[model samples]
Target chain A: DAGITQSPRHKVTETGTPVTLRCHQTENHRYMYWYRQDPGHGLRLIHYSYGVKDTDKGEVSDGYSVSRSKTEDFLLTLESATSSQTSVYFCAIREAGAYEQYFGPGTRLTVT
Target chain B: AQTVTQSQPEMSVQEAETVTLSCTYDTSESDYYLFWYKQPPSRQMILVIRQEAYKQQNATENRFSVNFQKAAKSFSLKISDSQLGDAAMYFCAYRSYTNAGKSTFGDGTTLTVKP
Candidate 1:
């Protein structure tokens, strides 16, 4: 409910194909993050952006790349999709001084 | 680095009964934040409660409350008068006071409320 939306709520791609997921926020928050949720593993951060064109890697950033050219949109790309990359991806936004993050609906990706 | 752990993978409780979910974290920092998030079958994540390590008193929201033991490094969530709607996956998370908006989350505990 924080004015966040993830494009392509669902996606299917073959292995070795390129895939990109989009996260758009209307709240104009300064911080945006990409996370993947898996069974028994919980949610793990993939990448995050603090401001326009400013980004950082997370604990599970391998095989994944992100770009934040604008303040409203942050993109997560997988150079080459793999079966291991299939999972529910969530996007979250937070204000500069806020302690909590608001999440989007999430995107389900499948690699065949 | 901070890590969160939820010892219980599953739990059950009858309607109107009280249930407590366990959570523990490893952190050396003196100040930080802890949170409980609920994810229903709809897959929407909702914030249930939050506690600031600097506060001695526990944080409560309606029928939900937290028992935070700083010295023991334990944070547990107590749900009172549990309802069927409370049946869902609960996650405990820890955030550093100085870290940029990043949080470490526990695996999760599935709570089943029997009517």
Candidate 2:
């Protein structure tokens, strides 16, 4: 198991509310990624951070934002939650020059 | 752009039998990586095996092995002596060597191992 952890393992929020999920890692890996898993779509990348204050959009970046101020913490925020955003979010970290990514326990979010 | 496809939505195998999961990908990049990840009922993602495009030989981890045909754009996972613990959703993913380690994943195949 990797030293990765996702906070708020399960959450439910009403539409149009603000919600943020946190991913913390102890490995100090340079790359951190956020993905959302949905039926028939598998896991889609939401966003990724290569280093502190450096981030990039993924295939499904809409309706989500991410920030990394430190090496160990990466945060994903849904500015205004929507029903479409209801899914399982996962956080993964990859060390530099590593081919495999270590995943954290997923966070399940529900938007009513 | 890259896309991963897992044609089988579900499969079942008797315990101690061997089963293979199919995966095909489309990529223009010559050098990349392919991976198989297993997500049990607990929903924790575990890396089953990985194959580097540059490597001609397939990669194996214990009972899990991959058949990598780079020219065919095919990567399949073979589980030998399957156990009930192998029952889970298996995902095939593709990552380019140039990208920042971002991956494109297939819809996934659910494996059912009957004891």
Candidate 3:
């Protein structure tokens, strides 16, 4: 698809349950990022990966963990989902050190 | 660390007219990049325009152009002959050199096209 795909486009989960969102990219880009969009706050970076096994946290990384085991896949895990975690999650990919990015369609997660 | 700021929370423009969305950023590095992304109702983020800090010339894509004022640390998007399809949320973003490149996004401006 020459694009990024986010799995489970829409999800409904109960609080205290673990949820994982997967981001797969056919572009094989070295830089991958996860961001959450909330009302008023816009998009805030949760985590990002520069390469396989090279990941770092962004401004709002609490309660979220990410792993980049391969260049094509970046996984975001919510150890225990909460109502406040309900938001649209976006996955983005770009070449190393490039500003231009291609984003996935986004995943809408709801915690009840 | 770099920060991107989009001042206009919402804006309205008539079809076939022009509208400008304002943005400003803060960074200490000399080399960086700025970008604008559009998110439609589908929630798909698409790249609108991009500019490299080293380049003095503004980057333009069709009717979409950026007013890059490096001295003022300002980057504004101007859409000319706006179309109904242009109605969406426009996000201004900034990326700077760190151990790895990390992008910071603005609050975004919702542009409404009134026909």
Candidate 4:
């Protein structure tokens, strides 16, 4: 389980509304990432944070924003939710001495 | 950019038997890392196994092992003594040794464990 948790496991909201998803990790890993999972796309990274306040855009960063103000808590926000953004979101953490990444349970979001 | 390919979209394996999932990758770097990730219905992504390009010996984790063919740019996962719990969506991933944050993943192979 990796002691990782994602808030609002499931959410259904109308378009043009704002949404935010939170990911909390007890492991205090150095790296955190936000990804979206779709039918044929598998998992695509949206954004990643190497350290607090230091983030970078991933392959699919449009329409999504992330913030890591402190360790253990990473937040993903959608300024204006759209139907195309409806998908499962996953958060992952990479530890210092390990090549593997631990993922959170995931948050399923649906935009109407 | 690194890319991983999982040729098998779906595979079925009998319980207590063995199955192999094929994975091929494209990368210009000589040193990199290959990984196999399993995502069960629960939606948690777990690392099944990992192989380092610099190491000639393949990496093995209990019932899961990888065959790393550096020359062929292929890294396949072989499951021995398959169990019902092994049924999941398997994803092949690639990461450059120099960078740990970026990872490229395959579409995924759904493995069904036949009883």
Candidate with best DockQ: 2
Model 3 chain B worst lDDT window (10 residues): B94-103
DockQ winner between candidates 3 and 4: 3
The candidates' interface RMSDs, in order, read: 0.8, 0.8, 1.2, 1.2
Clashing pairs in 2: none
lDDT tens readout by residue for model 4, A10-112: 9999999999999999998999999999986578889988889989998899999999999989999999999999999999998866788888889999999
lDDT of candidate 4 at residue A49, scale 0 to 100: 88
**Candidate 4, residue B44: how far the Cα is off, in Å:** 1.0
Q: Per-residue alpha-carbon lDDT of model 2 for A1-112, expressed as tens digits?
A: 7899999999999999999999999998999999999976679999999999999999999999999999999999999999999999999999989998999999999999
**Candidate 4 residue B115 C-alpha distance from true site, Å:** 1.1
- For candidate 3, the clash count comes to 0
Better-scoring candidate (DockQ), 1 or 2: 2
Best model per lDDT: 2
Tell the DockQ for candidate 2: 0.89
Per-residue lDDT of candidate 2, residues B1-115 (tens digit): 8999999999999999999999999999999999999999898999999999999999999999999999899999999999999999999999989779789999999999999
Once superposed on the true structure, which residue ranges of model 1 sit more than 4 Å away at CA? none
Listed per model, the TM-scores of chain A against the true chain A are 0.98, 0.98, 0.96, 0.97
Candidate 3, what DockQ? 0.77
Each model: TM-score of chain B?
Answer: 0.98, 0.99, 0.97, 0.97
- Each prediction's DockQ against the real complex: 0.78, 0.89, 0.77, 0.67
lDDT of 1 by residue, B1-115 (tens): 8899999999999999999999999999998999999999888889999999999999999999999999999999999999999999999999878768688999999999999
Question: Where in model 2 is the C-alpha error above 4 Å?
Answer: none
True contacts kept of each: 0.58, 0.94, 0.77, 0.48
Q: lDDT of all predictions, in order shown?
A: 0.95, 0.96, 0.91, 0.91
